[model samples]
Target: MPSKIPDVVAPGTLARGEQPVIPVPGDLVIRPWVLADAGAVYKAFQDPLLQRWHARVADSESEARGWIEEWRASWADEHNAYWAIAAAGSDEVVGRIALKSVVLADGQAEVAYWTMPEARRRGVASRALTALAGWAFDEVGLHRLELTHSTANEASCRVALRNGFATEGTKRSAGPHEDGWHDMHLHARIKGDGPTALV
Candidate 1:
């Protein structure tokens, strides 16, 4: 990964506009995933809670590999930014946060995140979301970031609210989960709100 921060956009600013761009929370570094990370990400995604909540169930190792490779390609594409999260002291990936389906004209993006079961309750997801949202606003030139969680997911709701993402409403039968079609709580955050003060 490059030691220097790549040019990203700030919140409220249009990507098409002429403004100096830089990564936010500059210390919160992100890098492309190497092939070695496949195992860790696979294991993390396979966790029952994450699998059910994230709706990520691959048919086989080949499918998982394809997904990981696609994630790698997204880093270079700029339209999708998926990061393997690590704290300052550790190289082991504890979680992942992504800016997905970005629309430059709309200044909007969808955010998704998950933390390893062993790393839960340690504020890993909260920290990563804070840093990622700050970057999205400060450098990605995105004004709005949206997230969705199953209504039963209290922890994710807390993370979203703490990050200043307003709970917009529920989307009934929005999607299917391990149980069945579930209502989803939609949440959103804007650029100027700063980080969610939880932690």
Candidate 2:
């Protein structure tokens, strides 16, 4: 039997066009990842904070290249969308952001991001997240976006809150870190929640 409600975003919406480069405030842009960004990606994963929070590390530039290729392929698969946060006129990757675990039928995805050590304290993550959220809601027509982070990650919580993703609740021992399991905070924003601060 068919369900009463239809898909919030129909299939083929993402595949209909190439992923776009979204511009944000502070002269940064959220653009698709490319092979040339491998070195920066490899280096970013080496940061102690990033490795601890994300629970993964790029062992080499080759591994980073493979990761980039996978991100590109996911665009075609419509399962995920990843972008590099960089300056307007340069390819240097100052950060990374993505819409992961996309469920087109439900019009929802989980947002994730990490900034390079050199870019911390400069609003890079929050600014890029605002831009990506705008594109996800306005351009992709997603109905909701959600994000999760270890409750200990106060910086991530700030970024999510700053971007309009309201804190929903905490899930105990939901995330694994270098230290051990961590309580995770769940945050979400719906399409009707209105524009985020920098959107």
Query: Total backbone clashes of model 2?
Result: 0
lDDT of 2 by residue, 61-116 (tens): 99999999999889987889999999888757899999999999999999999999
lDDT of 2: 0.90
Highest-lDDT candidate: 2
The 10-residue segment with the lowest total lDDT in model 1: 18-27
Give each model a TM-score: 0.80, 0.96
Compose the digit string of candidate 1's lDDT tens values, residues 78-133: 57767777544455767777888877656788999888899899777777787777
Highest TM-score, which number? 2
Candidate 1 regions with alpha-carbon error over 4 angstroms:
1-29, 58-63
Error of 2 at 137 (Å): 0.8
lDDT accuracy of residue 121 in candidate 1: 90
Error at 141, model 2, angstroms: 0.8
